[model samples]
Target: MIEGPMGAKPEELDELCELVGKVFNWQMRENFPTLFCNDNTDNLRIIKEDGKIVSHFGFVIRDMIINGCRISVGNVGAVCTDENYRKKGYAWKILDQAIEKYRADGVDMFLVSGSRSLYIQHGCTHVGKVKNYAIYRGMPIPSAKVKAIKYTVDDLPVWSALYRNEPIRFHRPYNDFLVLTTSGLVYRPDSRLFSISDGNKIVAYVVGSCDNNKKSFGLHEYAGSRKAIIASIPQWFEELNVDRCVVPVNLYDIEFNQIFHSLGIEPDYGTTGGTIVIINFPQMCERLLPLFEEKIGSHIANVLTFSERDGNYVIGLDGDEAIISDPHDLARIIFGDPPILEAPTKIPAEGKLLDVIKAIFPIPRPEYGLSYI
Candidate 1:
């Protein structure tokens, strides 16, 4: 018999954790304390078969600030089904219910950690454009002018302060920051945090990981002065003795892109590390109205109307409008399509509609470093 597409009660978490650990082969409770803890019990949606936990889908609700406007994000992860339960659609059922539940709770979007066909079929997409840059050994980058030191637990206050300066970022509560950093669950198991200081005043920080062979570094998340960060890279490379360094710059980060461009280093285009689904497209766009007005002017933004009917989305401006039948295509345009991916042909390539989209879209998304589920 089947039971539940319901929230896990506190009593069921032990079994839930065990099921997730067996499926993913990691300690869910330990690695993702923010999501798996009792505080998030209701968010850990699950299915049961004759009193045994068989499927689970978990998420953490986060509020993001994009150009000072609040955009709610549901970070989905820890999803799995018992081996015998595969192909039964339990995962899909739980996912569907979770989305409906959170959408009502004001989750504007969902950032899923995986890119399975299940997500794609459900309107999730690889959106937003990012540029990947790499620095090889002896690449002639500037010498380090700032002092770099390994991050310490005591430095959380300073680190939090620095992170808050980002124009687009997660509104990480201090406790969540503390738990995530100490949990050692950054995207890479070998991830390390470094604080960059210019003469005793902290100017920047970076969280990076080295490959298994320790020959390359992946800069996952960085904050504060871009110049200071770039200056300290060579020092990090030399100290870690890694031959190469990788930095992913979001398209909205013009200053960082320009700095790398000035150095004659062209980057490869890519997507941010996960699939995203706009849970409530109209609400999300409404929240971004300030940003829309700022970029394309109040006249155009005020005249724009967003609507959806029968799963097809419409974005309009006065007389000209673009109707997107596929939600995935809509996600690409709303989030900014990577050139490597298909563009929204449904929208005019050139016109007032395109101009308005080109000016405002590809909203800057925060790199999920410590916030990763």
Candidate 2:
């Protein structure tokens, strides 16, 4: 067996691609290429045997500003393993190496869009759920007054500016921003690139792209006053002329949910949601302290113990004034299932205390967005 970092040879990438295609029963369009090439992010690892790659994973290094502090994060993607190598632990080995790399790179948290069970084994916890909502093409316009217009290429700057101001969390850089603006309509191919104008000034806007089939639209991010966003929806729908339009939902955002509800639309499919593992508890706690302080209006204390057993977690929460001996037990009461918790004992505590801890250390289950690896 051989294991190493990818090199500069194109032929090696070709072989790796063949291995992935065969294992996954998919075809490679142009062979394989170094994932790090031309991409600003550098979180990739590969496993090989006899110069033939057997498994691989990729990550992108990102920095998120939380409470005025920038936290380094690793977003995982491109997980694939050769079929013949299955059950031989090649995938586990590559993931272990990736974890070590993430630690060395000073990442405080890691995010992924894959099997929650597999990730939990690596100390990741369920953070949030992701939802995709789509409106089929030719579906009668749901009664909302908005204009749809074609977008051109001159609206990049406005789109980027709008994206930077939105409150949504982003997992990558915004350099690949592109904008298509025409007449009074705009299309953002990349999240950061957008379109805007206030009656004439720059009051409202929308940001998204057409689907791979070119017959539908996917809205990854959007910001502006509620009215502005509402008004632009129909315009976007008309411009795309596709069978469907999709957007992600942040379930915690009540206002966002309310807006969607008022529109008389709902999501089509459901999935487990997004996952985040807190690798550095202290760092994450410190970063979230201010938010907690603001929400609770008092100092907070808690002891969180996380253990891994048989690819699952055994968590214990103890605070100065309260105790939650087993998170799994608590899960049964709250979510009906211990989720991925390994222990089943429940701890009794004041409902207020439970609420406070939940607010601060929210297990985010985010709706999946339009963008995927």
Candidate 3:
């Protein structure tokens, strides 16, 4: 009989293999835990029952560069439960465990992929708008003075600089860069990394993965001069020559959004690529206060403070404070989602203040799926 994602042991690995293999048949069941482990098992977690594996969940701890600071993030993945165990509350329990693990481990944020509803119920909110689109046979290409080169270890610092230009991004150290560049995510093998260099300096770079099956093609990450990235897209698309290519870009990417808009390629705007749950609201607020103030002005931003009382988070403005009924809703406002105002409480952006807040936090640059496409 299948159990929940509660208890686990090394001997249960084989049974776990059968459970996930039968559910997600992408593998031949021969590679099991290694592929699931992604080469590291120190942080893997699983739940088993009656000497067999039933439900599973795993996470990887990584640092995201937010406003030039390293904010620890726990990326949750490989979530699965035995088909027979679907309604048994195993997944939620595992999710609870994960939340605590991340919080205790000092992770400031938690990121999970796939269904937003499932996570939203647990105080997480979908963040960032992404464009999923197709690159047709005759997509527009910009004139690029730089040439694309296969990315190498020596070019890591250059890539890091490019990545850092954006305020929010996952911090990929040289080792992580090597791993993803060489192997990508375990599931997607066709990933490619390249750089565009002008004369002697690398001006831009892009990382993308289009499955061998051609069913899924997408540009995952890009950095460097906006012009350089724009110029290189056409050539890259032409090189791949897939019937259709999908690309996801941050909603705040005015440069790219304008380019695509002018080219008649409409972006399907959305924030559903990934879900985020804030583990430490006070800390997040403190960290983001400067940015918030910078955007919304000192009047509103100065009053922007966060605190927890009686186990509920409340946003403060002066001496007044309003409890954020739902953490997800609070995330929505801070990240610049629509409908910024709420009934007056103690929150910084409440009632009429929302009008002021919206102007400042408009077009937030938050991103998800940066770890992969």
Top of the candidates by TM-score: 1
Q: Which stretches in model 1 have alpha-carbon errors above 4 Å?
A: 342-345, 348-351
lDDT of 3 by residue, 4-119 (tens): 44434445555655676777775522322233443444455666666556777656677776566566777776678788768777778888877776677778777776655557
The CA lDDT at 341 in model 1 is 69
Global lDDT scores for all candidate models: 0.85, 0.50, 0.64
Estimate TM-scores for all models: 0.95, 0.66, 0.77
Residue pairs in collision within model 1? none
Count of backbone clashes for each model? 0, 29, 4
Query: Which 10 residues in a row give candidate 2 its minimum summed lDDT?
Result: 179-188
Predicted candidate 1: what Cα RMSD to the true structure? Answer: 1.8
Best by lDDT: 1
Q: Give the higher-lDDT candidate: 2 or 3.
A: 3
Off by over 4 Å in 2: 4-42, 65-70, 123-153, 176-218, 242-247, 252-255, 260-272, 301-355, 363-371
lDDT, residue 261, candidate 1: 90
Report the CA-based lDDT of candidate 1 relative to the real structure: 0.85
Error of 1 at 236 (Å): 2.0
Candidates 2 and 3 compared: the better one by TM-score is 3
